[model samples]
Target: MLRRNFIAARDLEAELEQWQERIDIIRHKLKFIRQLPGVACIEQLNPPGTAGGRIPALVEIAGGTAIASEENGLLFPPDIVILMLPGKSIEESLREIGSLLEQPWFAESPALKNNRIYVTDCREYFQLPGPGMIDSLEILAEIINAGDFHFGFEGLGWIKFESGSPKNG
Candidate 1:
């Protein structure tokens, strides 16, 4: 049976309201590229050198669709590639990703050709199901509509592949 929902505190309402405000701001910044054209995102947790992985739920929340693993062989090209690694520092993760990018398949993928690769720390962002989910949504929104927004990644825990370093603004 489906469980009923409950609101335990007034502060929860306030927190939600704050999240909504942040979402609205992000949505506004992403209005131009609301939906990535032919976007296909994959989330690999604790990648190559490590173990454990899962689909990223934030894709839908960020307004993009997630390509099922079963269909990996069917797509001609995906417009985006997202690497979600928990616990690893940005440098280590990037090194792993750089190797992956060198593979024939990944090198030819449209996501790389168009420079749409992104990386993030799952521990600080998308690993679990929680209220903090909104942060990942916002980060993806910012990344997807990057061209339109021309903004920095400062506080966001995610990074675009091309930037090579975290943004301070």
Candidate 2:
């Protein structure tokens, strides 16, 4: 109120009120998203696929702090991606995931037979190894996404994706 052209107190108060309302709405939306079935800790997307475009990085999902330790600034590139296992039923969940993912592959290898091997269709087959071999999962391949994943395994410790190269030596 010092200067006539500065601004009116009423107008300033009304603007502040509108901003507060918008902030409240955004906060509610974020809370709702957090309560979703498979909410993840993703910051951004590389946008390679169509359906499942909003995927999180392995380091982000696994709670890894160092992102630069990986090959590049990211654990997986646009072609190579990571997912959050926020739910169970790997196969059913995979089908639920959209096409932002390419060359769908499990985190486990094909050595161990009893892990996840099934063939609903005669043309396609799948076989996954145990969790101990999960460290050898594909680097370029995308990670399956889930916010509330529940896998029946011997051990399931979250590992940082900043340890090694994309391929094993």
Candidate 3:
């Protein structure tokens, strides 16, 4: 029984190693040759703060700069803004974002001016940690480097926010 268990553990380790190699290849392919875009991930809106947990690290891995201050507020104008409210669907998140439209910060943000705001399905992609986090990273990659990577996640895993659009709210 001991030998059997050992063999099983070794096999699992080898499989995980292979899986990591494949993930590395994908990461390598997604590398941006130019400057990384400044990204702000908002996990909450009320008294707004930057996303907590693994999101910031994941943003960096996806080839974007996660810009936030120690107080959890935005330090500078971000090129892209992502809303990933925990347990909220894309539609629900959109409704919440509409409220931000009235805020001076939201109204004048570079992301708003450039129409670079996005809403993500946090429950499905970003809420939990594990393999799903890989999908989350891919989602970020698609949003940040829209020109190069195209995993076809748009409209499914995420939606670009267009202010004043009836569908947004």
Best by lDDT: 3
Model 1 gets an lDDT of: 0.57
Per-residue lDDT for 55 in model 3? Answer: 87
The full ranking of all candidates by TM-score, starting with the best, is: 3, 1, 2
For model 1 the TM-score comes to: 0.66
What lDDT tens digits, residue by residue, belong to model 2 across residues 77-145? 232223333332334334533431222221322211112111111011111233222221221111222
Task: List candidate 3 stretches off by more than 4 Å.
Answer: 1-11, 18-22, 30-32, 69-73, 164-169
- Model 3 misses residue 114 by how many Å? 1.2
TM-score of 2: 0.22
Q: In candidate 1, what are the lDDT values of residues 59-118, reduced to their tens digit?
A: 554556565433223144556776666655456577777555654456566676777777
lDDT of 2 at 144: 24
User: How do the residues 6-111 of candidate 3 rate in per-residue lDDT, one tens digit apiece?
Assistant: 5588886887786576467557976635688889888866666778678888898788889773443468878888988889989888878865565446666778
lDDT of each: 0.57, 0.27, 0.77
Question: Which regions of candidate 2 fall more than 4 Å away from where they truly are?
Answer: 1-4, 35-169
Query: Going through the candidates in order, what is the number of backbone clashes in each?
Result: 0, 9, 0
For candidate 1, give the lDDT of residue 1. 94
Poorest 10 consecutive residues by lDDT, candidate 3? 160-169
Return whichever of 1 and 2 wins on lDDT. 1
